[model samples]
Target chain A: MKPHWLVRPGSIRLLWIVFLCILALTVLAGLLVHPHAAFGIDGSFGFYTWFGFASCIALIIVAKLLALLLKRKDTYYDGD
Target chain B: MTAISLIPPGLPLVLGALLLPLCTARLRALLVLGLPLLVLALVWQLPAGAVLSIDFLGHELAPLSDSKLARLFATVFAIMAFAGGLFGLNHMRVAELSAAMISAGSAIGIAFAGDLVTLLVFWEALALASTLLVWSTRTPQSRDAGLRYLVLHLFGGVLLLAGIIGQVAATGSVAFTAMALDSPAQWLILAGFLINAGAPPLSAWLPDAYPEASPGGMVALSAFTTKAAVFVLLTGFPGADILIAFGLYMVFYGIVYALLENDMRRILAYSIINQVGFMIVGIGIGTEMALNGAAAHAFTHIIYKALLLMSAGSVLYMTGKRKCTDLGGLFQSMPLTAICGIIGALAISSFPLTSGFISKSMISQSAADQHLTFVWFMLVAASAGVFLHAGIKFPWFVFFQKDSGLRPPDPPLNMRLGMILFAFLCIALGAWPAPLYNLLPYPVDYAPYTYAHVISMLQLLLFSGLAFFIMLPYLKRTLTITLDWDWFYRRLLPRAACPLVRALDAWQRRCSIDTLRHISHFLGALFLYHGPQGVLARTWATGSMVLWVVILLGIYLLAYYF
Candidate 1:
């Protein structure tokens, strides 16, 4: 069989590092280059970087609250 | 070529659907493949600005007309039918296939219809046919959902009808053209179209009912109804400011609900609302570029959304499981399915070099150029939310999370072929979008791929992925479902109805027993006293009359003598 190099323990750690590096590089690169600003705010360095992160967390918090009000048992309608 | 007058482009598919049950299985398959192709050819050959009118019920009905916009919608719709047909070749119920084809045909019908009368005809037919598709699954859940689907669509159909009647009364024409939303009738028309576009308060119907379809049926269901609404809204009520609010609500509602959702298909269903929300916002912006964005997004959305549904359906078909709670780690066995599903996810998130990247950016660009700062910011936030919820959540939970120890192979050959075809189209369009751009109603001037655009898009999406991993624990799958507007109908309405029905029953009982008894007693007494055999009714009355006459005669004599 071909070596399961992707699943090896060291390889997994290496993969995680690579992923983090890529994320950091994208953020760093975003600071270097200006996006043709859509709004005045979007042109700021790392606007997408921070906004995307914060909005996702904000969305999750809101969804969590909504879950309290709206969430029901999986079989809520069917009554099984 | 001969003038194709009487044969409306959609009729062949509708008629073919009616004939499907009569055909042997092989013949049925061939017809499904053939009908959409024929419609596509006819759609292309028909000249722009050609209108065919038929006299029906003393009103001229333009059942077939052509425009770049109509042709674009019709082309994508026909292509959708073909893909859905190919996917469903080996494993679909006869009834499902027939209903799906009929639904597809009617969508195409609406696309080509030049008059409100013809459009309404096709519109109502679409609701009925699609409801049949829902029920074709024949499951108890599907049956219940199908009934609700039918009711909601019929309600929308009535609104459209009332609006059409009012418009015809007010304007004295049936032409389906753009109108300012100044009158009540026009607002009603917008309301009707909005309801079908999965606007809030009625938006729950889409996620509730669509996931209940059979795997193949869901793929078809994802394509037609909402997109058709977008088409009509684009034509009828472009740049209506209220749509911006409605569209943003849908965009966020989809993300929040999808975030809370566990059923894989339901997640995708909610994302449909989310994606269509973008198109609606584009229409609301109402610039030439934005309208082009709306139309182009609709075209690309059909392909990618169907592809996403196809992947989810394949998982359901292979494993007989739908909830993320019951799914994971199938990438080991189903690499092709996983890859295609991931591609669909990336496209939906508008990652660079995807069809969504090409189509969706124009809407935001238009918003920015117009200096609508708040709209642009919200749209940007919503795009990030999309990547977080759909782009990462979908693939992460289904394929790569902790192994659920179930290893199902990829779907059958035809299903794979269908998914592959759409997957290819997604990338092909993303890499080169000119074909789709040319099909837009307006002229092409916007370039999707630029240094700033690609970099920002990647920054948004990749960071959203980072956020997902950080919040991994919060996004855990659960055995729960999120309630929405449908709860009013499913839970509250029924609960409210029970007390009402009991009160009415008690009131009827009291009226029947006590009130009826009193009326009967009064009538009986009157009958007895006034009978012919009674004393006052006979001799006594005659004696009294004679005595009075005698007294009157005596008085008259006395007066004369005096």
Candidate 2:
């Protein structure tokens, strides 16, 4: 079987490292500057970072559930 | 010059659109590009006041009025026209070009409208022109979609006109001005405006129809109608509290729907609602900064959204496909298109150093400034959701997912140029928003690039991206479409039609034929019993004659006895 560069083991590890670095830096960036919190807790370090992550996960889960209920064949209306 | 001598600023484009079809192809192309520039110049030169009025059927009509808000909307609209004209230069037919121009002109007409009557005229004109643009795609889907689009918009126009008539009748005036939700008429006006702004539960018209246009046609389609509605809302009902609720619903609604969409353009269509949702929220907040944000965001949004759609349009043009399920890894071949699409995606997500960043933050700032904590949090959440749905999902699925093994190159030169121009504007506006800020309806008092603000925005977006990566398996593309409000119209309504019609038909026949049958039965009985029957007519007459003489004598005797 042929191997793709992106899926190579070393490449996969590097990608993970890069992702973690970004996630960590984003969390750390909050320490450098304080947000004028709109809410009481939003002023905390990494507050938005965590909120953004949690909300996205929650939204995707809800969307997946919606997809379960509402999805039909792309040809649903086209009468295929 | 006196008002009598002045011309309405949008007339040249409107008239030129009529003349466009008569010319040769090249000449039509030249006129298409030249007409918008002319309109822009005319819009710029007009002073900020009601400059032209004429007597019309015993009422004064101001066809041209200029204010900071109106001019702001007019400027971006004209720029959009020019960019759209350029993009469609080689691809579109003469009819499409003319329709686009007329729509563009009417949008500007909406901006300059000084009175409700003139505004209604132009509002309906926009509907007519845009519907033509949709139909010019000349596909079956385009035809059906265009019809639906027309029906919905015309219904909205009726609401608007009804409201205008009621308001004018009650006030004994025709002027357009800021209004509150004090009357049913004003609420109707808001509904009319909200429909165009893609506010739900009527927003399905946008995603349902817009994706069916020709690639270049969609470019023009992306700009005018919704933004013009936003323009009117900004003019008419800036501080309506109910809009805040509607706007929040629309924001999340767009994200959820887009997440479930398989078609690339449909995803963007949902995002248009999302973007307009931000503007609507800003208008709802109705602070100075919020109004400015709404106006500024509208300007930047036209550019980036057009850019995004242009990229999607280019993909559809180069390859005869629009569904994300059928596209992937074209970025290897279509580098320019991919990069521009990414820029648009970033801009739309309000990433720092993009137009969306500079413009959209003001709305959230206002929410925070007013200490509407929940609204502020939701706006921030929506911003992150924007990144998840559009910023990464769009480009990632279309350009970088599992390779579909289809390697289509970039679109034609004019399209690339249009995308490049808007992409440049997206970055330029984000980097230096002074020019756009200067053009806003309010004073330029806010800055978008404070350190903490940029950091927080980045944190929200990057973490959202991280979440997207985490959820990659669940987000896989499939050949499925999620049901929306259109289900009522597209599925349920048509299915219900047959029984409804049969019931109505039965009632009609019962009323007419049943009554007729009963009348006929009565007439037949009357004829058989009394009319010209031989036995009764012949013998009875002779017997009665003889009896009558004897009866007369008897009656005389009886009368004497009595």
Candidate 2 chain B has its poorest 10 consecutive residues by lDDT at B1-10
lDDT of 1: 0.89
Report per-prediction Cα RMSD to one decimal: 4.2, 3.3
What are the per-model DockQ values?
0.64, 0.66
Q: In model 1, what is the error at residue A44, expressed in angstroms?
A: 1.6
Q: For model 2, give the RMSD to the true fold.
A: 3.3
Lowest summed lDDT over 10 consecutive residues: which window, candidate 1 chain B? B530-539
**lDDT for residue B483 in candidate 2, whole number 0-100:** 88
User: What level of docking quality does candidate 1 show?
Assistant: medium
Which pairs of residues have clashing backbones in candidate 2?
none
Q: Output the lDDT of residue B91, model 1.
A: 78
Instruction: Please give the C-alpha DockQ score of model 1.
Output: 0.64
Query: Per-residue lDDT of B1-562 in model 1, one digit per residue for the tens?
Result: 5466447889999999999989998899899999999999989988668889988767777998888999999999999999999998777788889989998999999998989999999999999988988887789998999999999999999999999889988998888999899888888888888888999889988988899998899999999999999999999988988888888899899999999999999999999999999999999999999899989989989999898889989999999999999998878889889999998999999988889999999998888888888888888889999998889899888887877888899999989999999999999999999999999998999998877788788888888888888899999989999988898999899889989989998888878878878787886786576657654455567678899799999999889999
Count clashes in each candidate, considering only residues at least 3 apart in sequence or on different chains: 0, 0
Q: For model 2, state the Cα shift of residue B94 in Å.
A: 1.7
Quantify all predictions' global Cα lDDT against the true fold: 0.89, 0.88
